[model samples]
Target: MTPRLSNQMEKFYKFPDPPELAVQLRTYSVQRWPTMNHEWRKNKLASILRMKARRLASYWYAEESLSPRVDELEAILALLKLPEEVIERENLNELQALKERVARLEALLAQAGALDLGEQVDGGS
Candidate 1:
């Protein structure tokens, strides 16, 4: 073997497989259950899983899309309630933070069927 070729060969060494590894590989290949049923059950299961994933994703997105103004009422809560990534990305200022807090409160109020903002009150004097 030439010195240059021997020096290059040193970088890549072919690993010798153990006897047990070879036996395991052979058995695994033969026992592998790769065949799957191409029927409606699998299709239904896949569709259900897909819908579940979409629902979960929508929930996450809903939680994330908040008004920054309502977020800063309680100094501690605003920080605690913020998602990890958002907190890491940037610090919320006073105005935006306040918006977030207000938004959250509004959401709760709306859920409780109170704090009617859309109604115009009139004094019939």
Candidate 2:
């Protein structure tokens, strides 16, 4: 008897490397600033997070004390009561920006007949 492959097994999964993941998290946090509830809290946390991101990025690149930075990040996440995974998900504003960019790129590529309609329709199956 042949075993059936799960949907997860059928697709390629590529996670971002540590530095890239840090950048993504930082970008997500900064993008979240405008929609944050309280004005002062929003400004304060955002600034602190950016600073932390800079420090963390430097330490990450230098291979220095990483645990402290990670602990700081966790504390920030806990104070915010936000899960890291939720923060990693694309927000609405970012989604709209990405959609616009994709549309523009698609238009340009379509002109050059570089868009693959078949693969898109088939969902790469």
lDDT of 2 by residue, 1-125 (tens): 23455544333123334455445544545556545544443345546566544454543344335533444555454534566556556355667898999999888768545655655745756
Which runs of model 2 end up more than 4 angstroms from their true locations? 1-48, 52-54, 57-90, 114-125
The CA lDDT of each predicted structure is: 0.39, 0.52
Clashing pairs in 2: none
Top TM-score hit: 2
| Backbone clashes, candidate 1 | 15
Which 10 consecutive positions of candidate 2 have the poorest summed lDDT?
A: 8-17
Highest lDDT against the true fold, candidate: 2
Residues 1-125 of candidate 1 have per-residue lDDT tens digits of 99999976653333212333224323322332124332332343225334343332332233344222211213223323456556444434534787999999888757655645334322322
Candidate 1 to truth, TM: 0.18
The residue-level lDDT of candidate 1 at 54 comes to 38
Against the true structure, candidate 2 reaches a TM-score of 0.29
